[model samples]
Target: MSSELETAMETLINVFHTHSGKEGDKYKLSKKELKELLQTELAGFLDGQKDSETVEKLMKELDENGDGEVDFQEYVVLIAALTVACNSFFWES
Candidate 1:
Protein backbone atom coordinates (compact mmCIF):
# COMPACT_ATOMS: atom_id res chain seq x y z
CA MET A 1 0.00 0.00 0.00
CA SER A 2 1.12 3.54 -0.69
CA SER A 3 2.16 5.78 2.13
CA GLU A 4 -0.07 8.71 3.05
CA LEU A 5 2.34 11.17 1.51
CA GLU A 6 2.50 9.09 -1.66
CA THR A 7 -1.27 9.09 -1.91
CA ALA A 8 -1.37 12.82 -1.45
CA MET A 9 1.24 13.33 -4.13
CA GLU A 10 -0.68 11.16 -6.57
CA THR A 11 -3.87 13.05 -5.81
CA LEU A 12 -2.16 16.34 -6.49
CA ILE A 13 -0.86 15.16 -9.85
CA ASN A 14 -4.20 13.69 -10.80
CA VAL A 15 -6.01 16.87 -9.87
CA PHE A 16 -3.65 18.98 -11.88
CA HIS A 17 -4.04 16.82 -14.96
CA THR A 18 -7.79 16.73 -14.59
CA HIS A 19 -7.91 20.48 -14.95
CA SER A 20 -4.95 20.96 -17.26
CA GLY A 21 -6.42 18.65 -19.86
CA LYS A 22 -9.59 20.70 -20.17
CA GLU A 23 -8.12 23.06 -22.74
CA GLY A 24 -5.05 24.04 -24.69
CA ASP A 25 -1.68 22.53 -23.78
CA LYS A 26 -3.00 19.33 -22.26
CA TYR A 27 0.06 19.46 -20.04
CA LYS A 28 -0.44 23.02 -18.82
CA LEU A 29 -3.37 24.90 -17.34
CA SER A 30 -4.72 27.88 -19.17
CA LYS A 31 -6.07 30.79 -17.15
CA LYS A 32 -9.61 29.52 -17.49
CA GLU A 33 -8.66 26.01 -16.50
CA LEU A 34 -6.79 27.25 -13.47
CA LYS A 35 -9.77 29.31 -12.36
CA GLU A 36 -12.06 26.34 -12.80
CA LEU A 37 -9.69 24.08 -10.91
CA LEU A 38 -9.44 26.50 -8.02
CA GLN A 39 -13.16 27.10 -7.85
CA THR A 40 -14.01 23.41 -8.04
CA GLU A 41 -11.25 21.71 -6.10
CA LEU A 42 -10.36 24.45 -3.67
CA ALA A 43 -13.62 26.19 -2.95
CA GLY A 44 -12.96 26.43 0.75
CA PHE A 45 -9.60 28.04 0.24
CA LEU A 46 -11.16 30.64 -2.03
CA ASP A 47 -14.45 31.22 -0.32
CA GLY A 48 -13.14 34.04 1.83
CA GLN A 49 -11.53 35.93 -1.01
CA LYS A 50 -14.46 36.97 -3.12
CA ASP A 51 -12.43 39.30 -5.28
CA SER A 52 -13.23 38.97 -8.96
CA GLU A 53 -9.60 39.53 -9.82
CA THR A 54 -8.29 36.79 -7.59
CA VAL A 55 -7.76 34.30 -10.36
CA GLU A 56 -6.04 36.84 -12.57
CA LYS A 57 -3.79 37.83 -9.72
CA LEU A 58 -2.97 34.20 -9.00
CA MET A 59 -2.28 33.49 -12.65
CA LYS A 60 0.14 36.38 -12.76
CA GLU A 61 1.88 35.21 -9.63
CA LEU A 62 2.07 31.50 -10.49
CA ASP A 63 3.09 31.83 -14.11
CA GLU A 64 6.76 31.95 -13.14
CA ASN A 65 8.15 31.79 -16.67
CA GLY A 66 5.56 34.36 -17.81
CA ASP A 67 4.40 31.95 -20.50
CA GLY A 68 0.77 32.89 -19.87
CA GLU A 69 0.04 29.41 -18.57
CA VAL A 70 0.78 27.32 -15.51
CA ASP A 71 2.97 24.31 -16.16
CA PHE A 72 3.29 21.44 -13.70
CA GLN A 73 6.33 22.94 -11.98
CA GLU A 74 4.60 26.27 -11.59
CA TYR A 75 1.49 24.49 -10.43
CA VAL A 76 3.52 22.66 -7.79
CA VAL A 77 4.74 26.00 -6.48
CA LEU A 78 1.13 27.04 -5.91
CA ILE A 79 0.37 23.76 -4.14
CA ALA A 80 3.46 24.15 -2.02
CA ALA A 81 2.50 27.68 -1.05
CA LEU A 82 -1.01 26.60 -0.10
CA THR A 83 0.35 23.66 1.84
CA VAL A 84 2.63 25.94 3.79
CA ALA A 85 -0.25 28.26 4.55
CA CYS A 86 -2.34 25.30 5.73
CA ASN A 87 0.46 24.02 7.90
CA SER A 88 0.78 27.39 9.55
CA PHE A 89 -2.96 27.58 10.09
CA PHE A 90 -2.98 24.21 11.81
CA TRP A 91 0.02 25.12 13.96
CA GLU A 92 -1.67 28.31 15.06
CA SER A 93 -4.88 26.48 15.88
Candidate 2:
Protein backbone atom coordinates (compact mmCIF):
# COMPACT_ATOMS: atom_id res chain seq x y z
CA MET A 1 0.00 0.00 0.00
CA SER A 2 1.15 3.51 -0.73
CA SER A 3 1.97 5.72 2.19
CA GLU A 4 -0.12 8.85 2.61
CA LEU A 5 2.68 11.01 1.30
CA GLU A 6 3.12 8.77 -1.72
CA THR A 7 -0.58 8.90 -2.45
CA ALA A 8 -0.58 12.64 -2.16
CA MET A 9 2.34 12.89 -4.58
CA GLU A 10 0.54 10.63 -7.01
CA THR A 11 -2.56 12.73 -6.72
CA LEU A 12 -0.59 15.83 -7.60
CA ILE A 13 0.80 14.21 -10.75
CA ASN A 14 -2.59 12.85 -11.74
CA VAL A 15 -4.27 16.18 -11.28
CA PHE A 16 -1.63 17.91 -13.37
CA HIS A 17 -1.97 15.42 -16.18
CA THR A 18 -5.74 15.64 -16.06
CA HIS A 19 -5.65 19.34 -16.88
CA SER A 20 -2.44 19.37 -18.90
CA GLY A 21 -3.73 16.89 -21.46
CA LYS A 22 -6.69 19.04 -22.44
CA GLU A 23 -4.87 21.25 -24.96
CA GLY A 24 -1.59 22.26 -26.52
CA ASP A 25 1.26 20.12 -25.27
CA LYS A 26 -0.07 17.03 -23.55
CA TYR A 27 2.52 17.40 -20.80
CA LYS A 28 2.24 21.12 -20.13
CA LEU A 29 -0.60 23.30 -18.93
CA SER A 30 -1.84 26.19 -21.00
CA LYS A 31 -3.10 29.23 -19.15
CA LYS A 32 -6.69 28.11 -19.64
CA GLU A 33 -5.91 24.68 -18.26
CA LEU A 34 -4.18 26.22 -15.29
CA LYS A 35 -7.25 28.37 -14.62
CA GLU A 36 -9.55 25.38 -14.82
CA LEU A 37 -7.31 23.36 -12.51
CA LEU A 38 -7.11 26.20 -10.00
CA GLN A 39 -10.84 26.85 -10.08
CA THR A 40 -11.70 23.22 -9.65
CA GLU A 41 -8.89 22.03 -7.41
CA LEU A 42 -7.86 25.11 -5.51
CA ALA A 43 -11.00 27.20 -5.38
CA GLY A 44 -10.45 28.19 -1.78
CA PHE A 45 -7.14 29.81 -2.63
CA LEU A 46 -8.85 31.88 -5.35
CA ASP A 47 -12.01 32.70 -3.40
CA GLY A 48 -10.70 36.10 -2.31
CA GLN A 49 -9.52 37.15 -5.73
CA LYS A 50 -11.66 39.81 -7.42
CA ASP A 51 -9.99 40.04 -10.79
CA SER A 52 -9.39 37.77 -13.75
CA GLU A 53 -5.79 38.87 -13.79
CA THR A 54 -5.13 36.47 -10.98
CA VAL A 55 -4.72 33.59 -13.39
CA GLU A 56 -2.74 35.69 -15.79
CA LYS A 57 -0.41 36.72 -13.01
CA LEU A 58 -0.04 33.15 -11.84
CA MET A 59 0.77 32.02 -15.34
CA LYS A 60 3.40 34.69 -15.59
CA GLU A 61 4.97 33.75 -12.31
CA LEU A 62 4.81 30.01 -12.73
CA ASP A 63 6.06 29.93 -16.28
CA GLU A 64 9.65 29.61 -15.17
CA ASN A 65 10.92 28.82 -18.67
CA GLY A 66 9.13 31.83 -20.17
CA ASP A 67 7.62 29.34 -22.59
CA GLY A 68 4.06 30.56 -22.14
CA GLU A 69 2.99 27.42 -20.35
CA VAL A 70 3.46 25.58 -17.05
CA ASP A 71 5.22 22.28 -17.19
CA PHE A 72 5.05 19.70 -14.35
CA GLN A 73 8.14 21.05 -12.60
CA GLU A 74 6.69 24.55 -12.54
CA TYR A 75 3.37 23.18 -11.35
CA VAL A 76 5.19 21.28 -8.59
CA VAL A 77 6.83 24.50 -7.50
CA LEU A 78 3.39 26.07 -7.12
CA ILE A 79 2.18 23.14 -5.06
CA ALA A 80 5.27 23.29 -2.90
CA ALA A 81 4.85 27.00 -2.28
CA LEU A 82 1.20 26.62 -1.38
CA THR A 83 2.01 23.70 0.88
CA VAL A 84 4.54 25.82 2.70
CA ALA A 85 1.97 28.55 3.15
CA CYS A 86 -0.58 26.12 4.51
CA ASN A 87 1.98 24.57 6.80
CA SER A 88 2.86 27.96 8.19
CA PHE A 89 -0.80 28.89 8.63
CA PHE A 90 -1.59 25.72 10.52
CA TRP A 91 1.47 25.82 12.73
CA GLU A 92 1.03 29.48 13.57
CA SER A 93 -2.55 29.08 14.66
Candidate 3:
Protein backbone atom coordinates (compact mmCIF):
# COMPACT_ATOMS: atom_id res chain seq x y z
CA MET A 1 0.00 0.00 0.00
CA SER A 2 1.21 3.46 -0.79
CA SER A 3 1.71 5.86 2.09
CA GLU A 4 -0.36 9.03 2.24
CA LEU A 5 2.58 11.24 1.22
CA GLU A 6 3.47 8.97 -1.69
CA THR A 7 -0.09 9.09 -2.92
CA ALA A 8 -0.07 12.85 -2.66
CA MET A 9 3.13 13.05 -4.69
CA GLU A 10 1.62 10.83 -7.36
CA THR A 11 -1.46 13.01 -7.40
CA LEU A 12 0.60 16.13 -8.06
CA ILE A 13 2.42 14.55 -10.97
CA ASN A 14 -0.77 13.13 -12.38
CA VAL A 15 -2.55 16.43 -12.15
CA PHE A 16 0.28 18.28 -13.89
CA HIS A 17 0.49 15.78 -16.70
CA THR A 18 -3.24 15.76 -17.13
CA HIS A 19 -3.18 19.45 -17.92
CA SER A 20 0.24 19.68 -19.50
CA GLY A 21 -0.61 17.20 -22.23
CA LYS A 22 -3.41 19.34 -23.57
CA GLU A 23 -1.28 21.25 -26.08
CA GLY A 24 2.21 22.17 -27.27
CA ASP A 25 4.94 20.39 -25.31
CA LYS A 26 3.50 17.28 -23.73
CA TYR A 27 5.67 17.71 -20.65
CA LYS A 28 5.03 21.39 -19.96
CA LEU A 29 1.93 23.55 -19.74
CA SER A 30 1.29 26.37 -22.16
CA LYS A 31 -0.29 29.57 -20.90
CA LYS A 32 -3.76 28.40 -21.94
CA GLU A 33 -3.30 24.99 -20.40
CA LEU A 34 -1.96 26.50 -17.21
CA LYS A 35 -4.95 28.80 -17.08
CA GLU A 36 -7.28 25.86 -17.56
CA LEU A 37 -5.53 23.87 -14.86
CA LEU A 38 -5.68 26.76 -12.45
CA GLN A 39 -9.29 27.59 -13.16
CA THR A 40 -10.43 24.01 -12.96
CA GLU A 41 -8.16 22.66 -10.25
CA LEU A 42 -8.00 25.71 -8.01
CA ALA A 43 -11.30 27.47 -8.49
CA GLY A 44 -11.52 27.95 -4.74
CA PHE A 45 -8.12 29.60 -4.37
CA LEU A 46 -7.96 31.39 -7.73
CA ASP A 47 -10.74 32.40 -10.02
CA GLY A 48 -8.45 32.29 -13.03
CA GLN A 49 -11.20 33.10 -15.49
CA LYS A 50 -12.04 36.31 -13.68
CA ASP A 51 -8.50 37.64 -13.23
CA SER A 52 -6.35 36.94 -16.28
CA GLU A 53 -3.63 39.32 -15.10
CA THR A 54 -3.00 37.18 -12.06
CA VAL A 55 -2.45 34.17 -14.29
CA GLU A 56 -0.19 36.17 -16.55
CA LYS A 57 1.81 37.41 -13.59
CA LEU A 58 2.08 33.93 -12.13
CA MET A 59 3.18 32.47 -15.46
CA LYS A 60 5.86 35.11 -15.76
CA GLU A 61 7.04 34.54 -12.21
CA LEU A 62 6.91 30.78 -12.39
CA ASP A 63 8.50 30.49 -15.82
CA GLU A 64 11.97 30.54 -14.33
CA ASN A 65 13.78 29.84 -17.59
CA GLY A 66 11.52 32.28 -19.42
CA ASP A 67 10.73 29.70 -22.10
CA GLY A 68 7.09 30.89 -22.07
CA GLU A 69 5.91 27.63 -20.62
CA VAL A 70 5.72 26.25 -17.10
CA ASP A 71 7.92 23.19 -16.66
CA PHE A 72 7.63 20.67 -13.85
CA GLN A 73 10.14 22.51 -11.70
CA GLU A 74 8.29 25.77 -12.15
CA TYR A 75 4.98 24.05 -11.53
CA VAL A 76 6.22 22.50 -8.31
CA VAL A 77 7.12 25.92 -6.96
CA LEU A 78 3.48 26.90 -7.17
CA ILE A 79 2.42 23.71 -5.41
CA ALA A 80 5.02 24.19 -2.73
CA ALA A 81 4.03 27.78 -2.17
CA LEU A 82 0.40 26.84 -1.91
CA THR A 83 1.24 24.03 0.46
CA VAL A 84 3.14 26.40 2.68
CA ALA A 85 0.26 28.83 2.63
CA CYS A 86 -2.17 26.08 3.51
CA ASN A 87 0.05 24.91 6.34
CA SER A 88 0.30 28.40 7.72
CA PHE A 89 -3.45 28.83 7.46
CA PHE A 90 -3.98 25.60 9.32
CA TRP A 91 -1.72 26.76 12.13
CA GLU A 92 -3.44 30.13 12.30
CA SER A 93 -6.86 28.55 12.36
Q: List, residue by residue over 1-93, the lDDT tens digit for candidate 2.
A: 999999999999999999997889999999999999999999998998943688899999999889999999999999999999999999988
Q: What is the lDDT of candidate 3?
A: 0.91
TM-score of each: 0.93, 0.96, 0.92
Clashes by residue pair, model 3:
none
RMSD values for the candidates in order, in angstroms, are: 1.2, 0.9, 1.6
* Local accuracy of candidate 3 as per-residue lDDT tens digits, 18-80: 999688999999999998899888888674345588789989999999999999999999999
Clashes of each: 0, 0, 0
Off by over 4 Å in 2: none
Model 1 Cα lDDT, one tens digit per residue, 1-93: 999999999999999999996878999999999989999998987798964588889999999899999999999999999999999999978
Residue 5 lDDT (model 1):
99
Full candidate order by TM-score, most accurate first: 2, 1, 3
Error of 1 at 80 (Å): 0.6
lDDT score, candidate 2, position 83: 96
- The lDDT of model 2 is 0.94
